[model samples]
Target: MPRTRVHNLNISLDGYAAGEYVTLDAPIGDAGRLFAGFDGRFIHGIDKADAPVTLDRVLTSTWAQGIGAEIMGRRKFGPQTGDWPDDGWRGWWGDEPPFLTPVFVMTHHPRPPIEFANGTSFHFVGGAPREVLGLAQEAAGDLDVRLGGGPSTIRQFLDADLVDVMHLVIKPVTLGRGVSLWEGLSGVEDRFTVETIASPSGLTHQLWNRNVPA
Candidate 1:
């Protein structure tokens, strides 16, 4: 069976996944420090060896591992709201997106699927978590479905108890104002057994997995 999972989601000590004032210029807001572990060389089609060998590198390198499909909120897809500005706007990613698998973007206003040359397609849909998950699972087939999010989307799946595994990277920073990952949900930890690993780079990796049913 294909499982729903979240990987390499970075959050601050203050519980903010992303900072304030998110725009096209600042997609992640003032939380640029959250991605300090990422190597710019890999993002620019440069030599992979130029990237640093750190725990972040190891985890980020496996972001798309075995992921057949992805589901993300509209915010993560872009800074657009209400109706799309233009049909020409595919997404923040260029012609070749990192996610080669099919991606479903959650939105109230659905649109025709956008196909890219690199085997990546964006399908906009409006529905509950289970409905969307069903669509993604059908597309994923035997592989896993990843919940790529901007906090709120992940929260919906978490609230619906649809996520099988979650990998969070807790950075040592604080954004006093922003969308929080753990708001309005209390006792969420009770559902999953968490394993924490401290990295030399001062970030902590936390893995949460639901208990297997006998």
Candidate 2:
């Protein structure tokens, strides 16, 4: 069975995943420091060809590995909200999106699918988490579906108990007010078996695997 996975989801010590206000100039907004130690070049994963062997690189490499399709929130797709403008905004990645697979953007407003030559296509979808996941899984075929998110979207699927695996990088700072990753879903960790690994970069990486019933 193809699994649903989330990787490199950086959250603050205060439980915030991303900033509240995301603009075109500041993609991550005030939460830019959360990814201060991240190397954008290693998003495609590390194979000893580019970056040195490190815990971060090793883990980041798994982001694109075996991921046939991705599901992201509208905010993760762009900074626009309510209704999409006619500015012809493709995404933050321009022509070549880092994701080589089909990406399903969760949105209430629908638009035509955007295709790219680099194998990254954006399909706007409107539905419940499970329904969207089914679409991604269908597109994924024999591979796994990646829940690439902006917290709110991740929370929805998590609330539905549809996520099979998740990788959270916890930073040691507090945003105080922002898009929180855990809200209302108290004790959500009880559903998963967590393994913790602290790195020298002061980031705690938590790998969460959904518990299997006996």
Candidate 3:
């Protein structure tokens, strides 16, 4: 069975994946201060890895293997409405985005297909979470579908008990307030368990696999 995996999901100590008002300038918000140690280029894995290549290895490997599709929430897509409406704007990633698979955008409003010069293609889906997940699974052939997110999307999946495996990169930085990772998870503790933990470069990478029986 193909599992749903969420990877590269970083969070701050104060519990924000991103800052308020996500403009191109302030992408991460206050969490930016906490993550100063991390090189943006390295985090994006945009280039080849050299010395202390563990971070590169982890990112490259994940981006390369076992991923067939991606699902992202609207907020992560970009600003909505205007001369360049939310639907008009492509993702922050430029002409050639790293992801080379089908990416389904979760949204309340539907839009026409937006194909990038790169292999990435964005399809907006409206309606229930189940519908979105179903579309993603169908688009993803044999490999797992990745939930590329902002916190709310992850929370929704967690709440619905849909996410199967998550690679949580807990950065050493802490944001007193911003977007939260697991803040709304008041219950459902039994739904997941930390399957593995690795510490590298002051960043704690955790793996949580869903606890439901196969």
Best by lDDT: 2
TM-score of each candidate structure, all chains considered together: 0.92, 0.97, 0.85
RMSD of each: 2.4, 1.1, 3.0
Q: What is the C-alpha lDDT of each candidate?
A: 0.85, 0.91, 0.73
lDDT of 2 by residue, 1-214 (tens): 8999999999999999999779998888789878787776776757636557888878888898889999999998899999889998999998889999999999999999999999999999999999999999999999999999889999999999999999999989888988888997899999999999999777899999999978
Q: Output the TM-score of candidate 1.
A: 0.92
Residue 24 lDDT, candidate 1, scale 0-100: 88
Worst 10 residues of 3 by lDDT: 79-88
Residues 83-163 of candidate 1: C-alpha lDDT, one tens digit per residue: 887757888888988888899999998789999988899999899999999999999999999999989899999999998
Q: Is candidate 1 or candidate 3 better by lDDT?
A: 1
Candidate 1 runs further than 4 Å off = 40-52
Error of model 1, residue 58, in angstroms? 1.9
Residue 124 CA error for candidate 3 (Å)?
Answer: 1.0
Candidate 2: regions farther than 4 A off: none
